[model samples]
Target: MKARSKSKSKSSILFILCVIAIFSLAFTGFKGFKIAGWEIKSIGEAITKGLDLQGGVSVLMEIQEDDVPSDVRQRTKQLLELRVNKIGVSETVVTEEGEKRIRVDIPGAYNSSEIVDGLSKTGNLEFKDSEGNIVLTGKDVKEATAVLDSTSSPVVSLELNEEGQTKFAEATANNIGKTISISMDDEVVSQPVVQNAITDGKAVINGMSSMEEATKLSGIISSGALPVTVKAVSVKNVGAQLGAEALPNAVKAGVIGISLVFIFMILYYRLPGLFASIALTLYITLVLIVFVEMKAALTLPGIAAFLLTIGMAVDANVLIFERIREELSIGIPIKSAIKKGFENAMSSIVDSNSTTFIAALILYFMGSGAVKGFAVTLMIGIILSLFTALIVTKILINLAVDMGLLKSLGQFRVKRGAENA
Candidate 1:
């Protein structure tokens, strides 16, 4: 029994340490390591931040009078999604707020005027014939990207699917010397003379006489044309300078919050408390790792969600510790009490965590902007709390007992009444 216990202790401690190290190294993107190829890039590095934390333009748009029915609004939402995707605004949020309004929130900073310029009008992607007849729509395009020639001439490179490709190739080929106009809504963007057959369903709008023009073209190509011009009724453009100012304060606040929880766990719970603390540290480290791995946006509001998770993690420890106290007061042996306490408290923990998780799910589905960020972090935090409280904390205690490493579980006494149970 003693030999098995020792081995189990070693294994448990080793697992915790390994989890921490692996997560740390992954987050660092192997910056200090010389491993295999792709050392500088990892799945963890791909996590993006939201506009509030990173600073970007937020433009609120209002719907206007239209002949289209309510069902058309649903179709409009899908097209808007396609348009946003085209622009490579990977962190963009576009959703219908009501029957007469839509909300679009995009992350990261932009040249204020440029974004406003692009957004000022409805995005309407259309390919016209020589006589200006509509030949293809945004749905026809398979993919789009920003491409540059050896001469550094930037263009919006596009590819169409089979049927659309055939139509596009024919359109460009037949209009050889004449102009094929590309327009958004009724505004003309490019009137390029067809230079060749473009049989591959590939072509460029030549009027992008400058890099800015090409970039806008790229954005438009990547983000399909908006179905309607969304007027910016309310606009706020946060500068990068503001982000620099706020980051340090945010970091300090987070440090303080986590530190308080860490210290309180160690001071109150005794032997189990120490184990909980270690698990807590690992819990936090893994939360960040999960954030990076999942590419969850870290926004200012997202930070609040993370902090709330810290509290939840602490709460799990509190419950378990209280349960252990209850068993102790009832005259159970320390070893038996530990096991019984964990087993008894588990149902309550599960119930509490599950309810919170459901709330997160609802918030994520129904809320947009910062609320979504908060919801995601809350869900992730609740999950991590459950793991640390049940599996991690229990493992640490069992390992210590098996090692016969500690003199007593007596030192875990705080003068708090047994009623804390």
Candidate 2:
């Protein structure tokens, strides 16, 4: 028994030390390691921040009429979001603010006026015949790009899908020797005369005076149109100062809260508490790694969800630890008690976490903007917490028992008088 215990102790210690070292390096980063696909940095630096944290432009747009339908409002918000994304920004928030107003928040944006002007346009790209008949719409265009024509003039190029190709061919064939006007929002931007059939599924708008105009027009064309005309009511630039101050304060609070939990667990559960703390650390490290890999934006609400997950992780540990103590009080062997404790607690852990997971899914699908951000982080946390509590904590505890580190009942927070049955 002594020889077996010694061997188990060596192996368990080696495994535990390996886990600690690897996670520590991942959390803080190492000189040679580049797991985050770039320069090695702390976990905090790897995550992308939202507009509230990084600062950018915020625009509020209101529809011209008072009684806009809900579907129109949603479509407008979605189109604005697409336009923002087309300009190369990520994690932009576009949501309906009221019955007639929509709000847009673009992170890392510097040109407020440019964004507001570009995003508020009623895209409505239309191809019209010489007789003013509609030939094609923006929906039929597959791609749009800005390029210089052979004459050294900037123009917007359009690649038509099968449907657009057919319609455009018919329109050009019929309008030969006549001008077909290309218009956006009822304003004609190009009126090129048709010289040939031009049935190759491609067309060009050549009225742009500069490359910038061509690019902007192409981007707007690529990102579809809004159903209704909206006007920007407010546009402002936000600074990073608010998030800079709040981030540190939030981190400090999380540290204090986790530290208190650590102290309480160590005092109440003795040996088991120390193992739980280590598992908790691993849980946090894994969560951060996942966020980095996903390139997820970390907002203030996301940070709050992260902290809440720590408590949920610790709660699972508390449940399993209590179960083990109960089994120990009945004079069960340490290894058997650990096994039974995990088995008994599995159902409850799955039930609770699964319910919360469902709720998070609902919030993710039905919610918008900041609410979606909160739901995403909460879902991630619950998953990682479940993994640490059920798998990592169990392995650590079984290792301790195998290494004879739990020979005394007091190690499990049970009374010493509970005689071995």
Candidate 3:
């Protein structure tokens, strides 16, 4: 009797702890707080909005192939993405359009002309001496970053590879007082006189008016040269007003859909359904927390994917509940039926969720823009749904049985003809 009493005590404590954790996550997700000088953002602030939901510039560029191979065009597109990202633009979309076209969408950017100019260049960085003798090129550069000089002025730091280091050292040693002009796309961006030979593979270019200019220059140099040229053929601007209009309706539909699911589950399955509903609520909260933490961009399709997974979450619970009911009708006790139901339903749940997860994984890798966002959210929701259904629901059901809230098989509403003898 004492051992049984102790076991129940432990179970009760675990049940309380689980409730506390769920509530804590919900509070943080809905209403963020600050602690120890660190601020945690609410889910609304944490999730990044995409171009369709926020105002941005979209440009369609046609590659000037000029006998360039298809592989080089693909590589140029990738490099362009890197340059865009390096400029501190988050949630930017760079994707291929057709065989020779590329599309770029930068959200929350007001100056489309500046962005277009920045992206149009081939970004071929070159260092030449006073007499116009080439010394080092972007291919020899290992990395570049923007930093402050000793006098607090903004400057760009360059780190070179072995070959660049050798060539640069020789150039600086030969031209101690002469200016080495650093140019991008045949335009001189910076011209600095070498005070001494730099043998450590590191150098700094100082002429930037501000940190922003230095950052842009560093980003361009780091992005490397494009394999082929591209010219903007079309440019479109998406307004934030459209996104603002669509957001509320999408959220309303999601809420109404989820509420309906909750009502259906409760009316049909009674006690088990109520437990499933609670677990599902926890699952949604956890999924949002994950999205915020991952800094994932939420698009319109992502919201749809989230709602779809909510239905799938309840489906798993229904399968387990029906299995439990079947076991109860066959003369099994409530506790044994609950355990057996989960054990028997595990395989089916795993098979279904795994296949869905694989599909989402494929889409994420192969798709771009909105499709990738949908795949990301779907993958997250599926994983969290499985967790809540298998782990959280099981724990809650066991706790209810242990607390004597669930006693007889009749509580599960077993059919008259199938009742245990």
Candidate 4:
């Protein structure tokens, strides 16, 4: 009996520590406490905002058909989308406007001219030696990555294909100690001196100011080339004034709705409801963390999806609590009742959440813009809700019971009587 008591005491301490850790992580994400002298942004600030929330540049381009096939136009559009996404722009929209025109919408971009210049360029990478002789092209490149050099300076490392290996080896051998100019769209992006003949197809371009510049160059080089040239026929600047006005109202509604949910859970299920509320708080924090980590863009529809998942999170707790009540009404012991409750609730919870996840997956693949954002956020929220409801809530309730804080079925609003037995 003494050993059992000691074990229970240890379990109680462990439970308390887990709760504290959860709260600390949640608080850090929500309030963003600083360490040392560096400032960390809160989860809200870390998440990328959509075009509707933050204004950016939109451009419509006409694909010039100088003997270019229709398939080339489509390929060009796809390549442009890849390039834009590579630049770290979240929730950017690239859609075919017509048979020959493509539309590009980039969020969080303030400079229209800079974006236009980047998007309009063909991004064809080439290496030229002195006397203006072309040594290698992007097609000969196998891969490109940004890395830190020996001095901790940013540089782009390149891997060339078989043909490129031969050509580069010959070029470097013939032009040792000479400068080779690397050009993108016929403009010199980098010039590096050839130290030796590179026979292994591996090379590095140094002298980048920052990692950002090196990464940009690497991404452009790795994205391949557009099959056809695109000319920007129209450019428009989108303003975020309307979205800014709507943000406060959206936040107010969300807060009010979630407050009502908390109150309902606490009042309806009593003890179990309180535990569920805490788990739901953790759920919200986890979802936001996922959004930030994924670099997902949050739009108006995405916010709606997040709110809807809160209700689903509560629903999961309600199901489990109802099962526990049923078991208690049958005069089962509290510990056995909790175990049976989760066991009975598992099938229903899995079925519902699985179906919802499937729907979200389909929407994500087929939808565009705001609809895609909504689907992505909904899927993430649903997964996190399941984790908190099924795992976190059960752990907390069991810990409370094991600690002797909850001993009677009466605490869960179930009376133990002869009739129940």
lDDT of 2 by residue, 1-421 (tens): 7888788878688767856774665556422346557666666766778777878888888899778888888888788888877766677777776588888888884688878888878899999998889999999899999999999999999999999999999999999999999999899999999998879999999989888778778888998887888899988787878767777887798889989989989999898898898888887777877887897778888888888888889889988988888887777877778889888888888898889889989988777667777889999999999988998877777777666666778777678435442
TM-scores, one per candidate: 0.77, 0.74, 0.76, 0.68
TM-score of 1: 0.77
**Per-residue lDDT over 1-421 for candidate 1, one digit per residue giving the tens place of the 0 to 100 score:** 7887678678667756755664575456424333666344543245576676668777666656666467866665665555454555567766666565666666676665665566655656787877979887767787766777667777677788888889988787778898778876677877777777777776665556776667666666556655554666767787777876676678789989888877787777666777787787777767877887776777788888888888888888888888877877666666787789899889888998899999999998888767877999999999988987899888777666555543254545733333221
Candidate 1: RMSD over Cα atoms? 5.0
Score each candidate by Cα lDDT: 0.71, 0.83, 0.85, 0.83
Candidate 1 lDDT for residue 103: 62
- Ten-residue region with minimum lDDT total, candidate 2: 26-35
Superposed on all Cα atoms, the candidates' RMSDs to the truth, in angstroms, are 5.0, 5.0, 4.8, 7.7
Q: Candidate 4's residue-wise lDDT over 72-180, tens digit each?
A: 8778888888777665665677867546788787876456775666677787998999878999999999999999998899999999989999999999999999989
When 1 and 4 are scored with lDDT, the better candidate is 4
Native-to-model Cα distance after best TM-score fit, residue 157 in candidate 4, in Å: 20
Best by lDDT: 3
Backbone collisions counted per model:
11, 0, 0, 0
Candidate 2 yields a Cα-based lDDT of 0.83
The candidate 4 region of ten consecutive residues with least summed lDDT is 412-421
Q: Which stretches in model 1 have alpha-carbon errors above 4 Å?
A: 1-46, 62-102, 120-182, 190-204, 221-229, 406-409, 414-421
